[model samples]
Each structure stands twice: as C-alpha cells, then as structure tokens.
Target: MEFIDLLLLFVTLFLAIIWFKYWSVTGGGQKNLPPGPPGWPIVGNLIQVVLQRRNFMYVVRDLRTKYGPIFTMQMGQRTLIIVTSSDLIHEALVQKGPIFASRPADSPTRLLFSVGKCAINSAEYGPLWRTLRRNFVTELINPARIRQCSWIREWAMDIHLKRLEKGALETGSVEVMSNCRLTICSVLICVCFGARISEARIKEIEAVLKDVMLMTAPKLPDFLPIFTPLFRKQLKEAKELRRKQMQCLVPLVRSRRVFVQGGRCEESNIGGDMEMVSPIGAAYIDSLFGLEPAGRGRLGEEELVTLCSEVINAGTDTSATTVEWALLHLVLDQNIQQKLYEEIVNSVGKKGSITEENVESMKYLGAVVKETFRRHPPSHFVLSHAATKETELGGYTIPAHANVEFYTAWLTEDPSLWKDPGEFWPERFLEGDGVGVDVTGAKGVKMMPFGVGRRICPAMTLGTLHVYLLLAKMVQAFKWVPIKDSPPDPTETFAFTVVMKTPLRAVILPR
Candidate 1:
C-alpha cells in the first residue's frame, strides 16, 4: 500500500507540475498586474501560509508596499490574490462584489464536506444561500426581532452587572475582558443553539473545540493536492475534528430545534430540569433542522449537521472576541468609560437599567461601539470567498475559483477614509469630526464592521446593540483599572480572532 501510494503521489505531482507551468506561462500576459515577494521555485510560499498564524495581514501589507496595491503568490498549486490597499479591496469586494462572492471549490472543502448548508459564511452565490440569508435577515437579525430579544441582552448584561459589583467591592480589579468575552459567548450560544448554556459549558466546549480546530489549520496537503499522500494523517484528523464537533454540536442542534418550533425554549424554573423546555424564538438550530430533510437541492444530512456546527462556531467566537476588545478599550480609556457611563445614566438611569424602549435613546453608547468595532474587527479578514466565473476586477480578470479576502480591520482603519485612523477616538463618530458611521448604507464605503455586500454579517445590528448595551451597563456600574501602572497592552496575538498577548487584567471599582 505504501509503495502504491508513493507511486500515485508522483503521478499526481507530474500532472500538477505540467498544469502549473501552463498557468505560469499563460499568466505572464498580465503586464499591469501587481507583484509580490519572491517565492521559492515549485514550493512558492506554501510553507509560510500553511504555518497557520503567520500574520497574513502584515505580510500582504509589506508586499503591497514593496510591490503595489494588488499582488499575487502561489500557496502550493493554489493561486492566492492578495489585495492590501483599500482601493483595490473595495474594487474587488464591493464594486465587483457579484463576481467575487463565492468560495473556492477545492479538495479540502470536499474532504471536510462543507459544500452546502454553511449559509452566508461558505455558501455559494445561489438561491439557497439567498433564501437562508433572507431568512436570517428578516427573522433573526431584524430590527424588530432584535428588539424583542432585548430581554436576552439584558439578562446577559445583568450577569456582568452582578460581576461588576462583586469585582468592585472585592478586589478593585477584574479580568473585565475575560468576563465580557464569556458573557457574549454565553448569549450568542444560547441564541444560536436555542439551548440554555452557561459560561462554564462554553469554556468546556471551547477547550475541546480548540483542540479540534487546531487539526484543521490550512494544511500544506490542503494546497498541494499531490503531496497529500504523505499527509494522510491531516486528512484523517480533519474528518475526526468534524466527527468530534458533531458529537457535541448535532444533538444540541437537534434538541434545540425541537424545542424552538415546539415553543419550549422559554419555560421557567427549568434551570436544571432536563425535562423542561425554554423558548428563545426559532433559533438557528431550528432553522438547520427544518432545512435538513428538504432535499430539493444538494444538501444532505451530514452537510446539514456540518453547517449547524458552523453556525455555533462562527457566531460564538467572533462576538465574544469583539466584546473582549470593547471591554479592553473601555478599561484602557477611563475618560471614555466615564463619558459612556454618563450617557447610559442620562438615558437609562444610574442602575444601568436599559429596556427595549430605551435602547435607541443611548446614542453615544452606539457611537462608541461603532468606533470600537472600527478599531478591532473580530476576524482579520472576512471568510475567504471565490469568484464563480472569470470576471474583471480592478482592471484585471479574477479567474474562476480565485479566492478573495476582505480585510475589514484594514478597511475600517484606512487613512484615506478615516482621519487619524490609527487613533482610538469615539468622537470621530460623534457629530462633525470628519467621521460618521453609515450603518444604514447611506454614505461612502468608509467602515464595514459587519462587512459589506451580499455576505455581510446578518447579526451585525443585534451584535452591535449587544456590545453597546452590555458595555454601557458595565461602565455605568463600575470604574475599571488595569492591573499594572498603565493600560491593557495593545499588541495582539492572532487566533481565529485576534487575542491580546496578555488578556486585559483589571480591577473593577464602583462608580
């Protein structure tokens, strides 16, 4: 078997070599196309990219500076198009959004079985994606639906409020960032899974899922299809991650969907009572379960289950990371905290009491959150998307299956659009400081915290409200202090989302 595998690998490599030579010779016609760092022969830059957390952002930025706005490199046989400048990013992602809106059809995707049912994250630009996107937009992330679930936001905030009081009285110090992340994780999990989940359970789940995610980091085998014979363990580990993920994810999804459509997500005194049900709308689980058997299209049971898991992983981590960053900023700038507290007090009173009715009244808190999101995007880039067809973009053809990435963090901080882009100033968004947030899609392409175009995040509004209301509640109730003489370190370590090299350690003091 080993001999046969090695023989097959060499045969595949021969074909790949011929195909790559053709591509390189044919691609040489692009006179105006951007340049990039010199890559090794055959190997290209596959090793650097597959190293997982190699800060593709900084590398791409450096390439843009050295080369031009748009650049290209080869990660194994996979052709990577990196757009660093905001102009190029906008031209590719927004102006030509329709063309660059799909995800690559690749071997790793097939191996992982993520072809369909992943919704907005990995869904192809088609009807099912459109329907699912619409369903989420109209029912789940809608303004009215978000308003209706104001209680859930409040409940999540109240947990932190209680913690703030305890932290203020006990230590005059707290890991506010950790607590914020935990609360957001809990809320988004409850919202997505339609089950009652605790912070302990989230941490437990994160512990295991963290290990599972480690195995699926973009492998060299993922790019160099011919080399996969030597990396069979990677293939097996990817499947195992999916299997383990399903072990935890599927049953919860099944149970919660049953509860949601049956209206059991809101039952009372059901804390530890496994027999009881709690109502929380037709949460994401119900949506997946409902779509599972309707096999009018390509989605199968396994694919549905996989997408259900994607729902949890995507919604939970990003929101939690954003909340962490927001709290970190709040702790770093006490004057901002004081201003936010005053706004919350003036709007919702001194207890930090907020309601569905009062949410819109806290305008300053909203601006502050919009600014925070501008500063720290949850993910360095939006999920990679692929163009479905050969299409023109930025005066060049984006060939079919070419992966496109949008750097929301970079776009939000672009100096051309933002005055003092690197500076953390909530006032930039206040009224007349040459900065204004166009969340309603009313202005130029300035900042896209929720992303822009068709694949924009559905829960952007609710997520924003959650960040504002929760942070306001915390700031109103407590004064925050970093553990050291200075503030939380701004240096970040990359994860699926950016994490502080040192988590913000602080003591919470009473107002």
Candidate 2:
C-alpha cells in the first residue's frame, strides 16, 4: 500500500509538470507582453518569491529595478502585469479608466465572503457595482452625511483618548496600533449600524472580521485551482470563519432591518446611553435596506452581512494603520510634532477640543497627514485590477483577464517625482515641486495612497477624516514619546495593510 501511494504521488507530480508546461507554452503565447524574469516550470515565479523570504512588496520593488516600469510575472496559472511608474499607472488607470476599472474575478474564498461579488470593492464594473458604490457614496459618505456624522467621531475620540490615558497611567507605555484600531472600528460600527455598541460587542465584531480578512486572503488554491483538492482543510477553515463572521454581523443587520422597517429597533439596549435606532443619522445598513440593484431585488441577509463587513474592515484597518504610521513619524521627529501641535492649538485655542473645522484650517496637520500617506501608504498595492477586454497599455498587449498590479508605493518613492522622496518631511507639501500635488491622479499621478480613477476607494474622504480627527485629538490630549531603550522603526510588513514590522510603542503624558 505504501509503494502504491508513493507511485500515485509521483504520477500526480508528473501530470502536473506536463500540464504546467502545456499552459506555459499556450497560455503566455500572446505577443508583445511585458518583460519579467524567467520562471521555472510548474511553479512559475513561486519558487523565486519563496527564496527571497521578504515581504512581496520588497520583492516587487527589487524586480522593478530590473524589469523597468512595466513587467509581467507568471504565478501558477495566473498572469500578473505589474505597473510601477506614475506615467504608466496614469495611462492605464486614469487615461483609460473604463478599460481598467473592473476588478479581477474573485477567488472562491473571496467570493464566499463577498457573497458572489455583491460588495462594492469586489464587484465588477457593472450596474451592480455602480448601484452599491453609488449608494455608499451618496447615502453614507457624502459631504452632508460626513458633516452629520461628526458626533460619531467625537464620541469615538472621547473613548479613545480616555483609553490611551488609562493605558499610559497603568502601564507606563501603550500600544498605539491596537488602540487606534479599536477607536476606528468603533466609529465605523456606529456608522454602519446607526448605534454605539458596547466595547465588548465591538471587540467581538472586530475579532471575527479580522479573522475573516486573514482567512479570505489569497491562498494557494486561489491561484492554482487544480490544487484545490489538497486544500480541503483550508477551505473548510475559511467556511467556518465565514460562519463566525456571519454570526457576529448578521444580527446587527437584522436589528437595523427591524428599525428601518418598523421605525424602532427591537434591541433598545444595543448601544450605551444613546438609542440604537435614529432617523436623523441613518446608517449604511439603512441604505442597504432600501437599495435595489438593477434586475436584482433588495440585498439578501448574506449580502447585507458582506457589505457591512466590507465597510468596517475596509475603513478600520487602513485608517488605523495610517494613524499608527503618522504617530510613529511624529515620535521620531519631535520638531515636526511640535510644529503640528502649535498649528492645532492656534487653530483651536489650547483649551478647545479639535473640531473638524479646526482640522480643515490647520495647514501643517494636513501636510503631516499627506506626507505620512506618501511615506507609508496604507497598502503597498491597490486591490488588483483587470482589463475589461484585451487592450494595449505602454505599447504592450494587455490580454484580457490578466491580473494587473499597480505598485502605488513605488510611484510615491520615485526620485523623479519628489525632492528627497525618502525623507518624511511634511514641508515638502507646503512648498516647491510638491506644492499642489494631485493625489487623485486626475491632473497627473504624483502619488495615489487611496488609489485613483473610477474604482478608487469610495471611503477615501471618510478615511482621511478619521485619520485627521484621531491624530489631532491624540496629539492635543497627550505628548507621545518613544519608549525608553527603543526607537521608532519604519520597516514594514504586509498584513491586511502594510504596517510597521514592530508595532509602535510609546509613552503618553496628558498635555
């Protein structure tokens, strides 16, 4: 029996090699494809990636040096076209927006969480995507809605500052990232469900959502569906995680549904002191309840859960991560921190709590946030984009359905684009070439932290507001100093977002 099993394993390997060779010859035969390093059979560049033992971002950075601005890689059955420079990115994503507006087809695990691509980010460029994205933008994050939601930010900020003070007094040092995550998650939850949930419940939702994000990340079976049979355990685990996620979020959806339908929430005790249901500040779920996608009926229970999950997950981690990075830079550069604090104090008298209006007025604070985004983007790469159909980009035939990667981080760091691109100097935005730089990539693609063009993140405004409010208030409430015997390190690793290799630890003193 052992001999038979060995023979079977060998036969399977032989068959896979043959299949890989056949695909390599025929699948990548398209002429005028971008240049990349030679790949090994069966594994493509998977072995090279493994050998590097670095974050994929760094690996791609090195490859960019060798392959020029545009390149291609064969990862298993997938073809990835990586675009690194500003001009090519603008040419593809902005100049030819419609051609590159759609997302790649969802991995099976991603589809499970996205409810068959019904959510905003995963959905293709079509009526469904438009309906969902338009609803989010118009209903939840429009300028009027953002103004109305100031109370939520204020509430979350109060709790966040108190928590930071408590941690600082008790431990003499505090972990900034976790506190930031909790605060951002709390604000997002209120916006999503139209209620201020208890800290315990908020943490429960955050935990499950975090698990879902990790489990649904691209896996081996996602790239090589032929190997799906070997990943039974992983797929099963993903399903269980999705179940856990549904368990945490679906009840919130049902509660909101009741409120939207009956004009009163069944669970009055859902929030702390405030009522969970409010007609004045309608939540994202409220909008979802009313939405009818073209040809499709109102969103189903599973779709509602998925959309709400996307809202929280998308807004929470990226915003929190940016706050952490910004704080770390401030800690490293006391002069910059002091200048920003002075600006905040001058804008809103020292005794005054930092308000959104005050935040808008503080030029230095805006520059600091912009510089942080440029230095350490929330994610090194945007969500993968795919061509709607076969098209030409940068003089190469971008075959249909190939995964196109825009290395957004590389664009910000390109020396040609900025003076001293490596430095974390916010003043660069205040004067000289960096002045009036366009982040939207409309005028030109200098830098795009939140991405650009049609499919850019819908929550960009809200996300930036969260960062501005949190960073301003935190700095106003306390003085953050690096921990004794330890210094700030900006070395990054990719999690849900690109984050510090060592989480920021600091001592906080009440101002």
Candidate 3:
C-alpha cells in the first residue's frame, strides 16, 4: 500500500510538471521583466536556491552583483522581483506605495496559523489591513501608550538583570540571546494580554510561539500548491501546532473579555466612574475586541488569538536578535564597550537605574543602536510584497503576481552609501554621511532596518525602544567580557530572525 501511494505521487508530479511546462510556453509573457538567469521548466531556479539554502542571502548578494540591483528569479510557480538598491526600494515602496502595498498570498501552513489571512501582517492591503494596523499602532504602541508602558519595560529589565547576574555567578558566563528573548517576550506578553503572567507561563507561551514561527517558515509546498499533498505529514503537524497555539492564547483572550465586561458593569453601577472602576490593561486585545471591519463584525476568538500571537511574535524575536547582535559587537570590541559604558554613566550619573529619559539623552548610545541596526538587521528581507496591479518600475513591467522583496542588508552595506560599510563604527552616525539619516525611509532610504513606506512594521517605534532600553540597561548593569577560549564570532544564521550562528556567551561582572 505504501509503495502504491509513492508510485501515485511520482506519477502525479510528473504529469503536473508536464502541464506546467506547457502552460509556461503557451502563457502570455510580460515584456521587459528584469533580467535573470535562465531557469529550467516548472522548477525555475528553485534547485539552485535549495542547493544554497543555508546561505540564501549570500546567494542573493552574488546575484545582485551579477545581475545588478534589480533582477528577477522564478521560484517554482512564483516570480520573485529582488530589489537591492536604496533608491529603487524607495521608488517602489514609498513613491509608488499603493501599488506595492499588498502582500503576496500566504502559504497553506501560514493560512492555518494566520486564521485565514486575518492577522495584520498576513492580511491583504485593504480595509481589513488598514483597520487592524491602525488599531495596533494607535492603541498599543503609540507614543503616549509607550510612555504608559515604561513601567513594564522597567519591570522586565529588573528581572533580566537579576537573571544575568545569577547566571554569571553560577556558570561563570551568561548566554545573551536566550536571556534577551525571555525579557522581550515578557514585556510583549503583558502589553498584548494586559496580564502580569507568571514566569513559567511566559516561557510556555514563548516556546509555543517559537515553534509556530519555525513551522510556518517558507517551504516547497508554500511556493507550489500542487506539491502540497506530498507534505501531508507536515501539514498535519501545522494543524496540531495551531491547536496548541490556541490552547495557550485563547484563554487569555477570554479572560480579558470577561475583565472588560466586568469593568463596564462596575462603571455603570458607580455612576460611570470608569477610571475608578477600570484601568488600561490588555490594550491590544481590548482594541481588537472593539474593532469592526467593514462588513465583518468584531474579531472572533480565533482571530483575536492570531492577532495577539502576531503582536508577540513580531516584536519579540526581532528586538531580541538585535540586542544580541549589539551585545556581541560590544563584547568583541572592549574600546567600544568602554565608550558606551562611559556614555551611560555620564548620562545617568550613578543613578540606581537607567530611566527612559536617561536613554533619550545618551547620544552615543542612540548612535550605537542605529549602527547595530544597519550592520545586523534582524531580517535580511522585509515581508514579501505584491503589486496591487500590473505596474512599471525602473523601466521594467511588474506583473501583479510577482513577489517583490527588498534585500535590506545589501542596501545598508552598499559601498557607495557608506564610508566603511564593513566596519561596526558607531561614529559614522555622529559625523560623516550617515548623520541625520532617516530610518523610516520618509526622506530617503539610506538603510531600512525596520522597512519603509505604507506597509512598514507598525510596531517600529516599540521595537526600537525595546532594543534601545534593553541595550542600555544591559551595558550599564555589567562589564561584558568575551569568554575565555571562546571568542565571539559574528557569523550569521537564519532563525525566526537573523541571529548569530553561535549565540554570544560573555562574562558579566557587576559594576
């Protein structure tokens, strides 16, 4: 029976390949598409990509060099338009924002986790996307809300410092990335659910979300639906993962709903003294509960779970990975570490704790954060973008079906844009051409660590603040030194985000 199933699958694949090859030949091809290496019928450069999957970004970098900044690659049934230059990225994502705003279709596994394209990141560019994105920004991560959440940051930092101190005492060194992940996840969980959860609970939720991220990463079936049946085992695993995810998050959503209802009743009973009866908690979920998209009612429990998961997953790994990269640089360069420590000292002046205001005043610290973002962006590519309609960009026809992605790491490292793109020099931001650069890409995209234009990550401000505060607290709390016989290596790997291939291990001495 197993042999029969395998034989049937091979026969189906062979026939599908023939049909795809014929369709490719007979289909109307768009003229003036960006030049790219010729690919085999049906597969179309996928073999090469798979052959070099481990260092995919490096492969893209070589292609950018060979084919110039704007080029194309056909990956299975998908047409990938790769843009590596800042000017071109700005042109497409900002100057022509609307045309390039919508996202490509989600994979089958992603659809299960995203609850059928209901999450903001996975939603199509339209009323639903706008409603969800606006609610997240205004309600949870706006400037005023961030100020209100300063206490949460402080609380997380205290726990983080204690853990690091304890680890150093017992083990003689601390693993930086895991601790950073824990701290960021704790802060985001509070912000998302408006509950001060136990540490064990936080770790549980974090582990589940981490599994979801790894499970939903791009796969062969994602690019080629015809191949999905061959991946039944993986698909079954994804469904189980989603069930586990709901098990972890749906209860929090229900609890928050009850809290909101109870508060409303109390406010009515007490002559509408809402402030006395209820305070702001679960800002993200609260906003979701109130949100009514066009034609659709308030989000259902599954949708709420998906959005809340998006919030936590989006903010946690990116910020934590960036903090790890920054700490690794500081550990490798003692002079840089000493300079940053001096800045923290001078700004706070032996204060017991580093305040948000203190972080604001430390210019050098800000420079280091910016430099870290440029050198080691959390992800090498932004979320895949799609054209709303057939459009022309940089004298090439962009078919509506093509998946447009910007190679952000290449843009930051382009020699023409910076003096020493290879060096981890924060001083570049203090002077030189890097001064006064805009990260939002509003003025021009010198380096887009967070991305740019209409579809930029909504939590950009919150994410940056996390990195800035955590890096400040970590540096001020200890003197970081490289572990003996295990010097820090900045080799890169693709995880949920771009992280150090070998996690940073450093000795932390209390200051």
lDDT rank, highest first?
Answer: 2, 3, 1
Question: Against the hidden reference, what TM-scores do the models get?
Answer: 0.86, 0.95, 0.93
What's the TM for model 1? 0.86
Error of 2 at 285 (Å): 0.5
**Model 1: worst 10 consecutive residues (lDDT sum):** 269-278
Runs off by more than 4 Å, candidate 1 = 1-33, 48-53, 106-117, 164-172, 209-216, 257-277, 292-305, 432-434, 439-443, 484-486
lDDT of 3 by residue, 153-238 (tens): 88889999999999998999999989999999988877876666678878899999999999988899876777889999999999
Judging by TM-score against the true structure, name the best candidate. Answer: 2
Tens digits of per-residue lDDT, candidate 1, 134-206, equal 7567657776666565666677778877876776567656765566656776666666665556566666666
Model 3 residue 255 lDDT?
Answer: 66
Candidate 1 yields a Cα-based lDDT of: 0.64
Compare candidates 1 and 3 on TM-score and give the better one: 3
- Across 1-511, the per-residue lDDT of candidate 2 in tens digits comes to 6999999999879868766664654347546888998888666787788788877788899999999999988776778899998999999989999999988876778888888889889898899999999889899988888887788898889989989888888999989899999999988888988877778888898999998888877777766777788988887888998888888877777766666776663436544343574453368788777688996787788999899889999999999999999999889889998998888788886769887888887889899999989988888899999998889998988877789999999977888888888899999889856789988889899889889999898899889989999999989888889988888787888788999989999988788
Q: Model 2 reaches what TM-score against the true structure?
A: 0.95
Ranking by TM-score: 2, 3, 1
Candidate 3 segments whose C-alpha is farther than 4 A from its true place: 1-30, 264-278
Candidate 2 ranges with C-alpha deviation above 4 Å: 1-27, 265-267, 270-277
